[model samples]
Target: MDKILINVLKEVQDNDGYISEKAMKNISVKYNVPLAKLYGVATFYAMFKIEKQGEHIIEICGSPSCMLNNGQKIEDFLEKELKIEVGKTTKNKKFSLYKTSCIGCCDEAPAMLMDGKPYTNLTIEKIKKILKKY
Candidate 1:
């Protein structure tokens, strides 16, 4: 059941960019699992998104290594440029900014995942350039 739930949630995420509350309830009814249980599964996993996201996602790492490498500066730059805080999507729904612990790029220290593609050794100039591409 857990596997099925994960698969279904992934499908919803792939199609909707999030798992809407209505969808969760529908899945609960179909699977005979409590709504709370479904939500638990969703929230427990970092991959599952409950709220709405944008067309593009920017996930910046906040691990110790990243923090030491001016990761906060990168986050600040993104917030200023996008005018949205972490866990928020742009008003136009074009981009979303998020923070994560580690992305297995500790060797690079400061790193980010833009739409699931890794960008390492981030700098303000580089981030601005990357945003332009998106």
Candidate 2:
């Protein structure tokens, strides 16, 4: 059941970019899993987004290596440029900002994932250019 739940949730997220409350209820009824339990499971995993997301997901690494390499500064730059804070989606739904513990790019330190593509050794200028492309 756990494996099934994981697959079901993944399918929902892949299709909608998030798990809506209506979807959760449907899953709960179909799988005979309690709604509260489903919510708890979804909220417990960082990979699960229960709310609506934007067209693009921007995930920045905030691990020790990334922080040492000015990841915070990059996050600040994005917040200012996008006019949205972390964990928030752009008003136009074009982008969503997130800070992740790591993105397996510690070798690159200040690395980021844009729409699942990796960008390493970021600078404010580079961020600006990247944003332009999105």
Candidate 3:
């Protein structure tokens, strides 16, 4: 049942871009699940977004390895360059920034997931170039 609930949530998020309060109610009624339970599941997973996101989502790695390799520096750069704080979308809606746990690129460190594509071994210069293309 947990797997089924997660799958349904994933499908809804994929189709709707985010999980809205109305959707949660619908899911609750349809599945006969408690709203709190559904909300808990959605919030527990990093992949589930409760708010609308920008065209490009930038999830900075917050692992110790990434931090040691200057991930904090990269995150600061992204916040400045994008002119928006983490967990927010830019005014132009072109990008959104977030801090997430390791993306399984500890080997590369300083890594991030942009629209689910991994960008590794980051530096300010490399990120500037990457943002330009996006």
Candidate 4:
């Protein structure tokens, strides 16, 4: 990581893995980077979490291609099985669900990413197995 990013990570670590607006502003000023640029970087990558994530981050691809298949079904299954809505963390804080645009693997429609690892061509059974691994 860059010095600036290391500093940012330290700051986030101090605040329970969440970067507050004030901290971001301070970083922008200290690093001489534009606030918009910092925010853009934070939002551009799925790995740079803005909010506090659970132990596991489950990202479902909901692009048109994925949706045309069984994306919705998979999403519904996750929500129902996890007992949490999209963008929400599980009650046990073990998982957080997010809907994302195409993860660049449309060939694997109805795919999901768990903590940055892509799992494609998912069925309920496969999803269950994947979750068990977590």
Candidates in order, TM-scores: namely 0.87, 0.90, 0.85, 0.69
Compose the digit string of candidate 4's lDDT tens values, residues 1-134.
35566567466756665666777788888888888888876776555666667899899999998999899999999999999999888888899999999998899788989988999998999999999999
Q: Clashes in each model (backbone N, CA, C under 3 Å)? A: 0, 0, 0, 0
Instruction: Write model 2 residue lDDT over 34-122, tens digit each, in one string.
Output: 99989988988889999899989999998999999999999999999999999999999999999888888899879999999999999
lDDT (CA) per prediction: 0.93, 0.93, 0.94, 0.83
lDDT, candidate 1, 96-119, per-residue tens? 999998999999979999999999
Indicate whether candidate 2 or candidate 4 has the larger lDDT: 2
Once fitted onto the true fold, the runs of candidate 1 whose alpha carbons sit more than 4 angstroms away are none
Rank all candidate structures by their lDDT, best first, as comma-separated numbers. 3, 1, 2, 4
Off by over 4 Å in 2: none
In the range 3-40, model 3's lDDT, one tens digit per residue, is 99999999999899999899999999999999999999
lDDT score for residue 127 of model 4? 96
> What global local distance difference test value does model 2 have?
0.93
Q: Distance from true position, residue 87, model 2, in Å? A: 1.6
User: Against the hidden true structure, what lDDT does model 3 obtain?
Assistant: 0.94
Task: Give the range of the ten consecutive residues with the poorest summed lDDT in model 3.
Answer: 45-54
Which candidate achieves the best TM-score against the true structure?
A: 2
Per-model C-alpha RMSD: 1.7, 1.5, 1.9, 4.6
- Predicted model with the maximum lDDT: 3
